[model samples]
Target: MSKTYTNSSTKFSFALRLIVVYLLQLFIKAFDYSFGGVFPLTFRGMIFTFTFVTYWLTIWYASEYIQKKISHLNTISIVTINVLIGIYCGLSSTVIYMLGDTYLFQNGDLWEEIPFYNPELSVALCIIYLLIFTVYAYVQKIFQLKEKEVNVEQLEKEMFKSQYIALKAQIEPHFLFNSLSVLSSIVHTDQNLASEFIIKLSKTLRYIIEQNKRVLVSLEEELKVVEDYFFLLKTRFGEAIQLQNDIDPNVIETIMIPPASIQVLVENAVKHNKLSQKKPLCITIALKENLIIVTNNYDKKEAEEISTGMGLSNINKRYQLIAGKNIIIEKNQDTFKVSLPALSTIDHENFNH
Candidate 1:
C-alpha cells in the first residue's frame, strides 16, 4: 500500500510540474499581447483571458493524452497524431469560445482594439497555440520517458532486495540447524559420506551468497543450485523424498529466471508435505510449452509449517517485475504445481538492459 502511494505521488508530482510550466507559458503569451495596451483589465477583459486560457488548456491536455497513448509508435506517428489532435482540439475550443463571445457578450461595450471579437485573429492565435502545444508535449514526453526508466530501475532494485532477504532467510539458523544435525549423524557413521555432505552444503550456501549480487540467473545456473539443494535433501531424507528432473537441455540454455526460484519451490514442497519411508514426497521439475514447471504429489502435513509465504510471494513478485509474467500455481486433492514463463534469450536480453 505504501509503495503504491509513493508511485501515485510521484506521478502526480510530475503532472503538477508540467501544469505549472504550462501556466507560466500561458501567462507569458498573454503578457506579450497585453503590454501593447489593446487588452484591458476590465470584467470583459478577464472573461476573454479566461476563455483563451481554457482553449490553451484543452489543447495541452489533448496532446498530452494522445502522446501517452501512442508512445509506443514511431516518432513520425506520434507527431502526426498529436498534430491532428492539437488542431482538432484548438479549432473546437476556439469555435466554442467564439460562440460564447458573440452571443453572450454582444451587448457589452466592446473595444475594437481587442482581438477577442475577431474570428480571424482567434483562428490565427489558436494555430500558434497548437504549435506551442506540440513543442511542450514533446518535451514532456521526453521527460516522462526518463522518469519511467528511472522508476523501472527502482523497481528492479527493490526486487533484488526482496530476493536477497528471501535467500538470506533460506540459509539462516533454522535451516542450518537441520543440515548440521544431519551432518553430525553422518560424520559419526561415515566420514567419507560426511565429507561429501559438507561439500554440497558449502556449495548450496555459496550459491545463496552469490545471488546477493544478482537479480536473475540463467536457467542452467539456477538448475545447478537446485541440483546441489536436491543432493542435500536426498542425503538427508534418503528414499523418503523423491525428485525428478525432466528439463530439456536446449531450453535450459536459452531461458532465465529469478535466482533461487526453483530452490524456493522445492523447499516449499519439503516444508509443507509429509515425508516418510513408506510414503515418499515426490517432486518433479520440468520444462514444457515455454514454461518451467515444478509439481509435487499431495501429502499435506498434519501440522502445517509456520509460514509467511515470503519465498513464493517474492518469486511471484519478481517475475511480475522482470518478465511481466505471472507464476502459475495450481493445487488439487492429489497434486500441487507451479508453472513459470520461460523467457527466451531475446526477451531475457531485452529485460536485462
Candidate 2:
C-alpha cells in the first residue's frame, strides 16, 4: 500500500511540473498579443495552447534524445547539446507560428511588419530551457543512484541471511550425528546416565529446532542451552573431560551468540583429540570483554581418530557473515582455542516476520 502511494505521488508530481512549464510558456507568448487590441479570445487561446504543446513536445524529445543517445556526454557537451536543441525547438515554434499566421489567418502583412528574426530572444529562451533540462537531469540521476544503492544493500542483506542459514544447516546435522553416537555408546553401560543424556539431547534438539527459525536468540537463552549441552558432554566424557565456565551473568543476559556454537567448538575439541586416564582433556569456556573463548588442552594420541575441519570451518563462515568478523583460532602443541564474538555484536536480530 505504501509502495502504491509512492508511485502515485511521483506521477502526480511529474504531471504538476509539466503543467507549470506549459503555463509559463503560455505567459511568455502572451506578450506578443499587443498588435491587435484584445485579439479574439478564442484565437488567442488556440495560439497559446498550440505554442505550449509544440514547445513541450520538443523539450521532451530533446530530453529523451540526451538520455538515450548521449547519456555519456560530459557536462559541457550536455550543455552545448541542450542549448542547440532548445534553439532549434524555439525557432521551429516561431517559424510555425509565422507560417500559421500567413496561411490560416491570411495575415502576410503582420509577419512582414514585425521583426521576428531576433536571434537574441531565441538564444535567451534556449538558455532558460537548457538550465531547466540540466536541473531535471541531475535530479533524475540522483534518484537513479539512490535506487541502485538501495537495491544493492537489500541484495547484500539477503545474501548474508542465506549464507548464515546454510552454515546453520551444516552445523546441526553434524552435531546431531555425534550426539547420537555418544548416546548409543552409553545406553547399555549406564541406563541412568543414558536417561539423563536423552533428556539433555531432547532439550538440545528442542532448542535447535526453535532457535534455528530465528535470526538471533537472547544471550541468556543460548547460554542456558549451552549449559545443557555441557551436561551431556560431561556425562559422556566423565572425568576424561574437565569443563570450566566463567561467563559474566550480566553479559549473558543481554548478549546473544549463534545457537549451538559452544557445542560445536567443544565437540570439535573432543573429536580431534585423545582423552584418557593418561592425558586429561581440560576444556575452558569463558567470556572476556565481548569475546567467547573456548580453549582445550591439546593431546594427540595414536588411538584417537582425527576429525575433518568442516565443523569449525562452517562456524567460521557463519561468524564471518553474521559478525563481519573472522572467527579467531589459536593452536599450538599444548592448546587449541577458538574465540567467538558475542551474538549481540553479530548479525543476529529479531526475525522480521
Candidate 3:
C-alpha cells in the first residue's frame, strides 16, 4: 500500500475500534443505574471504556493465534479449546482490570471498584467473539479446499489432453494413409515438391510430439506448426482448403498461446465440413486487439456425430484452466467464429507450474 493510504487506514481503524468499544462499554454499564438516571459522564466512564477494550483486544488476538494452532483438530476439540481461551482471556483481563481500578485509581478501596464484580457475564463477550472467529476460520478453510480442487483438476486435464493429442496424432491411420498416398502420386510427377510435402508432414508430427509436455507455447512457435500443418492438408486437399491469416509479426513474437490451438481449430473445420471444388472451406485467422480470432465457413458434413462440439469444449476448458480466460464462440447460418484471448508475458506468469 502507499504510505498515505496506510496512514489513513490506520487512523480509520483506530477510530472504528474506539467507537465499537465505547458502545460495548455503554451496553455493559447500562444496568447499574435506574431508568431516569443519566449515563456515566465522569472519570469512572473511562474505566468502563478500558474494561471492554482490554477484554475485546485480548480475547480477539488470543483466539486468532490459538485457533490457527489447533486448526487440524476436530470440531468438538476445537470448540473445547476455544471455550478455554475465551474464559482465560476474558477472566484474566477482567480481574486484572478490576484490581487496577481498586489499587491504581481508587487506592485499594473495595467499594470503589469500577465494575460491580460480575466477571461471569463479562466473559460471555469473549465467547461470542470466539464463535465469530471460528466461523471465519471454517469459511476460509472451505475456500482453500476449493482452490486446491481446481488445481488438481487442472493438472489431470493437462495430463489427459497431452496424451490424447499425442496419441491421436501418432496412431490416426487415415492421416498417414492420405499423406503417403498423396506423396506417392506427387513423387511420380515432381520429386522436389513431393520431398517438401514429406518434410512438412514430418515437421507437423514432430511439433505435436515435442509440444505434448507444454501447457503453453509462443505464438510464433505454434504458428510455425500451423503453417506446416496447413501445408500437409493443402497437399492432400489442393485448392479445396484455404487459410487466411493477417497476424502482426510483432504480436506473434511477444504473445503466447496454447500449443496446437490454431491447428486444432483448422483441423476441426476440415473434419466436419464439406470441402470440394464446388464450395471450398475457407478458414481465417486474425488478430483484433487482444483477441486471436478464428472463423470458418459453416458447412457441416452429412454426419450427425461429427459435430459433437467436444473439441471446442476442450479448448474452452484449457483456456479457463491455464489463463483464467475464456474463448468466445459465435455461430450463425453461414460462419462460425471463436475469439481467443491472446496471452501476454504477464498472463503466462500466472499459469500453474
Model 2, runs deviating above 4 Å: 1-194, 301-307, 345-347, 350-353
Q: Put down candidate 2 lDDT per residue, 1-353, tens digits, no spaces.
A: 32354476578647755776776565555566633332335675567566666666556755766667876879688667777788876676667666777787777776686557546546656766777677767776776676545544443554455445434643577666877788889889989988988888788767755554554556677667777877877776678888888876766777766666776677667777888756778888888877889999987666754555666766665555455567789999999989987766334442212
lDDT of each: 0.73, 0.68, 0.73
Task: Give the number of colliding residue pairs in candidate 3.
Answer: 0
TM-score of each: 0.69, 0.48, 0.60
Report the candidate with higher TM-score, 1 versus 2: 1
Q: List the residue pairs that clash in candidate 2.
A: 256-343
Model 1 Cα shift for residue 70 (angstroms): 4.2
Error of 2 at 325 (Å): 1.2
Query: Per-residue lDDT tens digits of candidate 3, residues 1-353?
Result: 22344466456545654666566556656754521233666666665566668767665556667777987999899888877776665566567656765676674554353464446555665665566556656655765576656665665576477557655844489877888899999998999999999889888887777665666778888888889989988988989999988888877988888777888888878887899867999999999988999999999888744455666777777777676789999989899899988988765665524
Model 2 global lDDT (CA atoms, 0 to 1): 0.68
Cα lDDT tens digits for candidate 1, 194-243: 99888988888887767745557789999988888898999889999999
Order of the predicted models by TM-score, top scorer first: 1, 3, 2
Off by over 4 Å in 3: 1-153
